[model samples]
Target: MIPNAIAVDSATGAPIVLAQAEHGAESHGAEHMASTPGEHGGAFPPFDSSTYASQLIWLAITFGALYFIVAKIALPRLANIVEGRAERIESDLAEAKRLRAESKAAEDAFLKAQADARAKASAIATEAREAVARQSDENRRRLDTEMAAKLAAAETQIAATKQAAMGNVRGIAADAAAAIVERLSGATPATAEIEQAVDATLAR
Candidate 1:
């Protein structure tokens, strides 16, 4: 006969079987043990959806705080520093331009002064040369006037000596003729007779 059930004996730690009443035949029993207290062997509990939502909310709040700090505080300070640097560069360029213009003006003044000095020097030299030429001409005119006066005085002296010598020669000739008449005629000839003889001899 077939057995009707099978069971485990907890106290003896062994399996047991029971037979049917009419023929004593055996059969298979249950495969698994029953559930007990404090055991967790079933499907996991359902996911906590609210826990994930709370975590995401905290992350968003932290990220927004950081973004506000960077945008409002850090970025404006950096922008001010950049603007100040640009203004400083522009001021330096303006100062350099002014210095260059001042240097150019100084150079122009120096060149003008040099030109004026040269012109004055040339004028002084011209005046000195003209003065020397004028003095030389005056000296030459004075010398010529003195030489002419001396030459006139010498000519007058020569003329006076020549006239005196001619007068003495005429007087000597008259005395010699009177002496010749006294010797030849044994007496002095009359002035009329001498004059007639000199005229007749000159005509012949």
Candidate 2:
């Protein structure tokens, strides 16, 4: 609290101290009135400059302490946490790259296996087709050989039958000639003469 300026009593020519009439306590009465010349020779006690100066100094000290704590301790801790997070992110990215490479390798192996299987299947099919063709060719050749043998046997039988039939026709013609000669001469031919005439007719 501030003290007010004192007013002099002109009639008495002395300093007049205003009093709080009902309070009866000096500390309480001083708070309510101006100071007299008896209280510090009629002047204020430098207006509490020391108190203001002390308050300003303490405020500055507290601000400096708080600033130092934040700059030296709290900021470094925060930086460390940020750095750790960044390192963790880098590690995670590296792990992802490794897994991707493994996946690609597996895919390549699967593709190669599929290609090999297809090639083997194609080869098998070709071999089977070739086998079938070979069997068909062998069957055709066997049938042609059997047919040729049968045709040759049939031709030989036909030729033997034709020769036998021609021999029978010649014997019939000779018997008829002998019977005509006997009728014209009115005599029977001897055995030797008949044999010689049959031979000559056959030769002619």
- For every model shown, what is its TM-score relative to the native structure? 0.34, 0.36
RMSD to native for every prediction?
21.7, 15.8
**Residue lDDT tens for model 2, 1-204:** 123322334234342332322332533454434443334333344574424665788989998999998899988998889988998999999999999999999999999999999999999999999999989999998998888888888888887887787567566656666677788987877756776677787768
lDDT against the true structure, each candidate: 0.64, 0.69
User: Scored by Cα lDDT, where does model 1 land?
Assistant: 0.64
Model 2: per-residue Cα lDDT at residue 56? 80
lDDT score at residue 30, model 2, on the 0-100 scale: 46
TM-score of 2: 0.36
User: Which regions of candidate 1 are displaced past 4 Å?
Assistant: 1-59, 126-204
Error of 1 at 47 (Å): 16
Estimate the TM-score for candidate 1: 0.34
lDDT of 1 by residue, 1-204 (tens): 112111122333232211111112221122112221111122132453323565678979998888898899988898888988998999999999999999999999999999999999999999999999999999998998898999888888888887787557545655667789899889988877666565565456
Query: Model 2, poorest ten-residue lDDT window?
Result: 1-10
Instruction: Give the lDDT of residue 82 in candidate 2.
Output: 97
